[model samples]
Target chain A: MMKNKKMIILLVITILSLTVLTACGEKKPTLNVYNWGDYIDKEVLKEFEEEFDVKVRYEDFGTNEDLYVKVKQGGSSYDVIFPSDYMIERMIKEDLLVKLDKYNIPNMDKIDDRFINLDYDPANEYSAPYMWGTVGIIYNKTMVDPLTKWADLWDEKYKDEIIMLKSQRDTLAVALKKLGYSMNTRDMGELEEAKAELIKQKPLVYSYLGDEIKGEIVGENAGVGVVWSGDAVTMIRQNPNLEYVIPEEGTNLWFDAMVIPKSAENKELAEKFINFMLRPEISAKNADYIGYSTPISAARELLPEDIKNSLVAYPTDDMIKNVEIFKDPTDIIAEYDRIWTDIMSEE
Target chain B: MKLKRAAYPYIVWMMVFILMPLLLIVYFAFTSGDSQSFLDFTFSLNNFKRFFTPTYLKVLTRSVNLALLSTIISLIVGYPLAYIISKEKSKRQNIMILMLVIPMWMNFLLRTYAWLTLLGRNGFINNILAKIGVSPLNLMYNNKAILLGMVYNFLPFMVLPIYSVLTKIEKNLIEAAEDLGANSITIFRKVIFPLSLPGVITGITMVFIPAVSTFVISDLLGGGKYSLIGNVIEQQFRVTGDWHFGSALSIVLMIFILITMAFTSKIDKEKEGGGGGLW
Candidate 1:
């Protein structure tokens, strides 16, 4: 009986090794794209895969910081990544992204001139604009007065009826902007002042959220929230009484962009994917599905007139002038993180 | 000869799955770089030094305190429930245990998110409180929320071990104590409690270790407002891009847990007169 058991064990080991070798040998020309969750349409992905005959593996992250960490760790090789404006700048400084060869991407001409020469990736050398929007107040008109500024988040009337993003950059930017300081202020005193103001506003705040804030706001559980314009558009569609406003004191203007990582092995496939996404019809579909503004001029023409004219989707030129794009604070990140944590820990 | 062949598969499985990954964590903990090449490994102490910072130390202590609190609370709540279940008829005992563990079959994150919906400012609890003209409590994004979440998640760990031990106790011992004119309280203290000591120790260790390392519940329930040690270690790998520091924090946490386990074992040995043995 014992001899029979030994023979069975040997047979099992042989079978397992064969399976492992077979799995490792089957490799295909593939592209791995990492982006935010609920930001892509499945039909578009299926179409891209069918047309190119290349396997597309997609992953998601809740925040840009989460994406940055995974790319930095070098755990998985990603052909493409979508990072926000400041994060792209940081990755560039760290020499983590590969420069795009514009020769291969004919659709680069479809993007508007406004998005091409942004400070994050000057001259459109390393990254392509994927989506762009402003941070703003999303509120239910029936539950509260119109909120027009960051300070309105601290109003006692809306106590426990407000939600804010939990990100250090966005929350701190709002506090800094409300205190009349630069959003990227590196001065220690100004940051401390901003931290104090945020602490004071904490009592009236409900909770910090990201994508989940939209459902809460739409359910009428939250009266106002600091949310992205894309999420606000989704919430407004669900509850027409919802209104979005770019705070009077100004807010951060952020953009998400696609870039190839320096460690990417399939550069050709990555470029092909970027060019595919930039096609006007494809870009318009993405914009309609994600409910975010498109930077492609051709796509904008295809949008419905009401969506094209919506101020929340496309802010007035004057409002755009007041907004500032975020810059990468290379060495000052640790200080900002420390202040944010300390503020959160306080009573 | 037959035994040697039979042991080969088990040995190979252990070496491949368990021992290999442990060896890798140790290797990477010492090695430094964004690349996989280990050419410039100089055996540095910098990674370990980062854990000595006051900020990280405070988070570590807070994690230990919260874990201890959760373990103690779960033990208090779970012990009576386990005893009651064990006392039930054998057929009912299985059903009761199944009912207790049914919630655990769902994904942990989903359950935590469900709690968020039930406890948020506009959640069910607050809505009901508001209807009665009472002010809603700030319960979702605070220490209270973290504690409630920890206890709810880990209570089963405390229950199963104690219940298993309690059910195995012979009924004749308790009957003999009652026949000898001993009161119910005295019999329970002497006969029942000592026999269940091993389960209590196992339950405490099981609940405490996971609670200390738990990051997601605290992050979601605590509103990312409070920084626990788990969050600090996560930030090192995620935000700071400092793998060396993260490995050091992990080593420190490992050392702390080892010391705790050692101390608990020593106490248990003394209580058992050093010869009864844990096994």
Candidate 2:
């Protein structure tokens, strides 16, 4: 009888302690922020949490498509998301994003005017610019000749020595650009032409790859690879023998931006976090760590002289002659997917 | 009553993890992708119709072909190893089994990724070849490489089951077969092999199912030249955002595997009946 009374007393103490701990946890509102994997500095997030006295729940996604599917399916609520050009457009079309209040994000002026009012978020109401880059060839100078044109990728001399992108849009865009067609073309005939071109080039190609393309090139397993400009910068740093080129036939100029999801519960806190990230020092820190170019002009100035002057990080306008930003391929996306499947399914 | 209550947690787990997802897959497979609201779904056969075309059939055929080739190779290689291990002393058998399982302790993706270094142009093999004044050979980015990966990963799954069954055979039965004037080969064929049929069935299922559904191994080793059904299904959900078509493909693959399991079990039952008659 004495043991049973002691047990009841112990259980009561445990229950009271648990409730107190949970009550402590509930004191601070959590802001869930989802972004691309390895894309942040992490220190900035910690700094924001300390500054605002709000808990930040951070998660990462592998691809833009993954981000889109996760948000669209709607199990978890994310206050802030970082999506790229075409993806931002798609989310706006689906009414998945909340319009940003300029009053909350006063640091919006830090972003360059050139990066503002872009096609993805035309009025700059939905998204804040984060980082931007171009898609081009990164090649070993010792293995291949100077690659000036996208048509050079088709030359038989580089047989089993070229690494193409595994991504459907990126790979298809390469073929489309080589054929002197727009990357965002809605015409079925143009898309079919690109598909045929890829099929023809498949024999000469070494493999279709994603992040592994960097390792393959640096290890000298492949002579040439099609990669984003940011990855090119990092690869060049790893192996000085590598050279980056935006092909004369033109390529994709892409942007990644921050937006609030419509399901966000902590809208005000999310804005505070975005404004914190837009600070010159914080943006510069992220740019330095991530090896991606920042859209903030002030952040660019604060970067080290070598990084600031690096042509690959910030290409001159004339250098990218016919570069195009990817738009939401809403109408032609299904056709594009079918063509991609066909290209990948070819025996 | 205690045992029944103990199973309640597992029942709840199954309902959430297995049964719910299965029902959801069936629902999504039959529904069109056009619906905006969560509750309202337009039931349609379009997803299934899309999968029945010549292009998708080719992908399915490729996945089955690769999986079958890997399974056959595994059985041919695994059976002898299993038999040899089963014949060993108990302590030594345990050691050998531990050796087999130790490689599996490492992550599967890491193990597969390590093959790239061993098989690449400037890799360990080619580095050795270069010292001998022989040119580097092309070993990566091919179908043969993909088969090697599947066999390497799934070989243990094929071997362990057969070994356990072989070890469990009654010693007296083998002794009696020998006393009755049966040779070693004759004894194995007439007695041991028949009894081990259940293990062999399990081994095949364990290896074949995973090999058929594997996407990572094919993506890494096959060099993205062609799409397996696994890759196609993954593309639909992740890349193309067509969960309806992805669900349909998954349903079809599941049915194909179920048919395979049924056929294997029938063979096992037939063997059991014949072996009982022999006894």
Candidate 3:
């Protein structure tokens, strides 16, 4: 009887080893998703892996331009990517993205109607809205007086204490909006006016910054910064004294959307991952992990009441009426380039 | 035959990595890159023409100007220090050189980032100043800060060459100058200075070229307040996706550095022909 039991155990071990060998011979199909660094929840990826039983290869890109270049250079194959509205428009124009099959993405209805049919991806043909946010003034109240407007950035008292966004569009948009002009205006005269305003404001600017503004503001290096909403929320948490104010002049409203690249080898799996991300629970978890406002209305409902009602994260409808989205300024970006170069090169 | 065969890998490396990229740059520099396709290009001078604008010219000149200023400062600061170190006992001289080189062991970016902490508005220096009831000075986000970062980063480049040359100069020459009734000043001006010319030139070349082409120091210390030529080229390739224009600016920057290099090589040849060597 003991020999018989031993023989049964040995037979089971042999079958298990054979199964492992075959599994190694033919691996699961993998889906590669490249996104902005630290832009997603860790647990959501694990959930996708378990639910789909497909291998997941995740990579992070520092910037949208870096992602575009990687795809253009054909160095690495990526199944899906997260790009902002302007970059999405550029990709669509360049034919770098594959059109989404709406049938596969059943959770697309979860995305708020307000977030859909935008200039960057009209009719939801190519991209699904992920996280949306606005750019605004993040200030340390102790160092700065109640900062309420873009003009407050150029206040003489804040000289050498202001940090402006480093990107040409973001900074130029601030100047344009301050002057009550449209942010996406290609008119050279308006751009020049904006340039002059920026030059005038330069002496007050301690540093032109990117994502590092959060650390700088929270650390009290600068009194005020023109920063993104999600980063502002993070900074406010780090330093309770710091407050975020979207200036009365208005700001840039941006959406980062997920879309599959045309070079993706596993389109079906990529669509599955996108649909997985849009599931209300997954989206809410992601929104809680990442401070950015969720685009899905269902996900927004799931957010903690304090964060969901926060004026900085979700501004009132009347307040955001004048806010503009960046259209892909393809033809005359060179002009903005020239203006920015001139502005930066000024002695 | 064995030695030649051993060099085969490096030759392949030079062809694949170095020469090919350079040739590709030249190819891109002359092409109209509206489409960004490698094959579908027209031979055009538009890239070069775009470079002649006053805006770009001013940026180029500013980069050169900043580099020249940093080189001059490094020479002034490094020469005396190198001389002092060379005049020390051999063991102490090695210690001094090592001390000069220790900071470089840390990454250049790390060293520059450290400067951000020390010179920032609310950084350590300002914290100290505030204790004494002194207003914090704006030590960053300007040309001066950029110059400081460049000098701090590249001073070793300047000092090592000068120190090497100074140490190599024969003590007998100094003794002979003194025996001829020449004072220390005369010995330094005529004998020591003239003999260190080769090292000075090498130091200048090393410091000036890197300073002129540096994007990181300016980006970090200058706080992206102003655009240098290096910044322009970086934006063209990385930010704007205009590799053709970037290649053109690179070619232009290359021409500037090449002129300095050629001029230095000519000086080196003259020094060698005129018996700049002592031993």
Best by TM-score: 2
Q: For model 3, which pairs clash? A: none
lDDT for residue B217 in candidate 3, whole number 0-100: 93
| Positional deviation of residue A58's Cα in model 3 after best superposition, in angstroms | 2.9
Q: Residue A327 in candidate 1 has what lDDT?
A: 93
Per lDDT, what order, best first?
Answer: 2, 3, 1
Ranking by DockQ: 2, 3, 1
Worst 10 residues of 3 chain A by lDDT: A329-338
For each of the candidates, what fraction of the native contacts does it recover? 0.37, 0.82, 0.76
Candidate 2 ranges with C-alpha deviation above 4 Å: A1-24, A27-29, B1-7, B273-279
Backbone clashes, candidate 2? 0
Off by over 4 Å in 1: A1-29, B1-54, B126-139, B273-279
Scored against the true structure, residue B241 in model 2 reaches a CA lDDT of 82
DockQ of each: 0.38, 0.72, 0.53
Superposed by TM-score, candidate 2 places the C-alpha of residue A47 at a distance from the truth, in angstroms, of 3.0
lDDT digits (tens) for residues A59-124 of candidate 1: 998877788878876879999999999999989988899999999888999999988879988878
lDDT of 1 by residue, B164-270 (tens): 88887889999999999999999989988887776777778888988998888888898776677787778666665556666777778888888888887776665
lDDT minimum window of 10 residues, candidate 2 chain A: A329-338
* Comparing 1 and 2 on lDDT, the stronger one: 2
